[model samples]
Target: MKDSILRLKSRLIRTLKLENLLFKFLPNGIYVFNLHRIGDRHSCQFDRNIFSCGVDQFEQFLLLLKASFDVVDVATLSQILDEQQPINKRLAVITFDDGYKDCIDKAAPLLVKYQLPAAFFITTDFVGSERIPWWDEMAFLLRQSTGRVFKSLSTGQDINLQPNTIEKQIAQVIFTSKRDNNHTLVQILDDMREQFPQARAQLAQQSNSLFMNWQDIHQLKDMGMDIGSHAKTHNILARMSTEQQLHELTLSKQVLEQQLNQPIKYLAYPVGRYHCFDQHTLDNAKVAGYSLAFNNEKGKNRFISERYSINRYCFDEGDLSTLKLNCIVW
Candidate 1:
């Protein structure tokens, strides 16, 4: 029954440690964390309990945010939110969306073994795509369909396909309701490629190399790591048009500042859901200059928030006390 109420609210927040007494009334500022894929959830092909988190639960969520927090960098939380300063500690930022290949083979070696400093947005046409992302090709054709049931020609709703985990929760509820409707997710993947034509040619012969290239994003910007822009084909910027959301936010920030020569500030919108970005996608991400922009709106971010819709907090592969009661209730 909802995994016994999330294992009794993760054993009452680890038996009342309550994240060190809710880390003393939180609210200092910035706590952005939105990861995707770490590793080895039984050799996950995709959707490992919603995009992944293993490698020792991401090194115990970076040792519980380095025993309290202050783990900065996105240019020091954009110069402490452009100088409204006053965060007397408890700052944290570490982001990652799309661009997977285990964010350069297993979360950049545990973010360089816990020195920690991440950003990594990038969907720039899946870096050097062979094409493995229409929601991991609809969870690899509903986990290699041997056929149990399947209907949803855009929501007629049959869906009883079970190869366990109720067929990855009905292929993540029909690929998150046709991923913000890119023409109804290309007409339901062209009617699931004419009804799974050889499971869409065995998901187009697999190996899309699971993302990350351009020399693994210039070796994650020579290991300091912070490369943004999750556009250029991650789509759903309020379903495009404002010149295709300013050409997917200025050509994925001018091709990641012309192949990582630098200066590609930030952005994380693609399916960063609150209707997937609007208000002309935040005035075309501040006329494509972009100092900061993120979504997936959950909570925690201040210095009067809203540098183009800040808010973030999403982690998967649950149960480190439900990721410490979602960082003490977001």
Candidate 2:
């Protein structure tokens, strides 16, 4: 039923060309779009559909954005917002979170082809570690497990796992961990590792080429790409103490600047959900010498928008219509 409603709405919007009329009403401001990965979805080891934008779809979206608005870089947008300059035309800025190998191999070429500039936020720990992220490791373990039933050590619930039920289990555990402010997710993953000892080796082997190295980052910087900090360990800032948060923010900026020999001025909070960062996190970002900080909150950024909590819109292939609606509405 829900799918039917969405398809109908998409057809209506496309057939009636409501996006054209709605575009006129959209306020002129910086529309920042957050992207994650760009490549073959079928080749991915984890949940690709949620985070990936296929090459073809990404090209289409880029063309549409370029035709409808002026594509600007982070520096240009920051200057415009700082100066309180009037926006005579609509503008859009592109950003990629999580420094994946595909960003350098696939996404960069497309950006160069379009002559569009973008920022790539890097998690300091992952750049040279050659390890899959904790979340991806969790998904991999679940997908590899042969057990049909296992008790959750953190939630004390009996989860029935099957081919169809693995994703739900992963999602529920992650949601609970984020909500509780406890490291229950880590405990759950630990339990899974104990049950499937061989999974760790498999994951390590698979994750060997998932992240970019320092040389790739240096090449990106030389290619005129903006390099920003995505924190050291990608920890939730709000859940950490002030000192830990400061360490994550400061260390990442220092390391990136030292390695790339360029000043890192932007930050995208890890996870970037509402609860992932707080007032203290923003204050620490300022102290860390970051000029701009971004969150994953949905909306456009006005001239007077908060520099420390700038909002961004995240979209995938299935969200083109929703993205258009958000561009006009928010």
TM-score of each: 0.33, 0.89
RMSD of 1: 17.5
Q: Global lDDT of each model?
A: 0.76, 0.81
What is candidate 1's lDDT per residue for 236-326, written digit by digit as tens?
A: 7786678889888898899989988778988889868788778999888989899888897666765645788888788776455555466
Candidate RMSDs in Å, in order, are: 17.5, 3.8
**What TM-score should be assigned to candidate 2?**
0.89
Off by over 4 Å in 2: 1-21, 205-207
- Give one digit per residue, the lDDT tens place, for model 2 in 83-108: 87887778888999889888899888
lDDT of 1: 0.76
**Model 1 residue 13 lDDT score:** 70
Q: Go through the candidates in order and give the clash count of each.
A: 0, 0
Residue 303's C-alpha lDDT in candidate 1? 60
Top TM-score prediction, candidate number: 2
